[model samples]
Target: MAGLIDKAKNYVAEKVANMPMPVATVTDVDLKGVGIEGINYGAKVSVDNPYTHSIPICEISYTLKSADRVIATGTIPDPGSLVGKDKTILDVPVKVPHSVLVSLARDIGSDWDIDYELHIGLTIDLPVVGNFTIPLSTKGEIKLPTLSDLWSKNPPQSSV
Candidate 1:
């Protein structure tokens, strides 16, 4: 009987050890706007208490898929910290004029899909056991508004 229980436990662990992780597309990187900025990333961790008493640190990587189907990838370690407990606002404190650059296909369109992935982790020393990434998604729209479109919303306008 004990052997059966142990086998079951081992099986469960194995299953969890190699489960499919959800992919997150970067919704936005708020840090790019301001110096010592806090990048606001949107990706909900499906599991409860992903950190579990461990400091959830993150490594951000930038990637781009051009309209021409060209794939470019670059990683930024310790780009910022995951701000908040459990899984909340993934705020990454970044340096001024961040080094990471994500250039889109200007030939196709001005819109670019910037991906800022948060890799929740305790410590790199712990190896795979400490590394954790919430299978959350990150993607959104950030279209540049025109001057008229931006100003027309406000009142107190008159032709002088």
Candidate 2:
């Protein structure tokens, strides 16, 4: 009897281990907009669902780091759900305050860009398995908007 129960447990474990799971990746990160609070950047995430049913996304948490310092971090709760048996693209936004930019002046001054690493946690509710978290990370450089670029967008009015 003991041997039979042990074999059953082993079979269940093997089945779970071989189950198909969702896959995710960070496609790109770019400047989204500028506001009074500071600069807003968006990270594009692509997730592929293997199941034939839509999965509910519980939350998306992110951390933005520059020059080995954590510049920004936040979480988006109940973002939405992923498409069934298809790829879903999500835009995760991170805001860096003006003061934080000033603190990173040394790194930004060198090449007029910020070298960053973005870490994201995508949580999804899978059928029967409950919640599963897919960890993603990417590193790249983001160019800062120069004075000329800003001026070009909103030219200064000539004083009469």
Candidate 3:
């Protein structure tokens, strides 16, 4: 009886290990907006679901780091579901306070850009398999808006 149970467990494990799962990658990270609080950046994730049915996304947690310091970190719970048998694009937003930018002046001043690493945890509920987390990470440089670029957008109106 013990041998029979062990064989069953091994078979199940092998099936689960061979099952196709969702794959995700970070496409891009760019500046989204600027506000009094600071700057808003967004990370675009592309998830390719192999199953024929939609998967419920449990949560999306992210950490933004620069110069070995954490700039932003947060979790988005129950964001939504991934499209089945298709590619789904997800937007993850991160807000950095003005103080944090000020602290990283040394790195930013060099090339007028911020070098960052974004870490993401995408948790999805798979049928029969329970919850699974897909870890993703990407590193890149984001150019800061120049003074001229800002001025061009909101140009000062000459007093009439």
Candidate lDDT (C-alpha), each: 0.36, 0.88, 0.87
What is the Cα-based lDDT of residue 21 in candidate 1? Answer: 35
Instruction: Check candidate 1 and list the clashing pairs.
Output: 25-138, 26-138, 27-138
lDDT tens readout by residue for model 2, 5-103: 999999988988888999999987877767899988888999999989999999999999999999999999999999999999999999999899999
Clashes (backbone N, CA, C under 3 Å), per candidate, total 3, 0, 0
TM-score to true structure, per model: 0.37, 0.90, 0.92
TM-score ranking, best first: 3, 2, 1
**Per-residue lDDT over 1-160 for candidate 1, one digit per residue giving the tens place of the 0 to 100 score:** 9999999999978977875432333333331232233222222222223333434444644332223332334444754343323433343332322133223335214443332223322211123355665433333332222345335543221110
Prediction 3 global C-alpha lDDT: 0.87
The candidate that achieves the highest TM-score relative to the unseen native structure: 3
Q: What residue pairs are clashing in model 3?
A: none
For model 3, the stretches where C-alpha displacement exceeds 4 angstroms are 151-160
Q: Give the Å error, residue 137, model 3.
A: 0.5
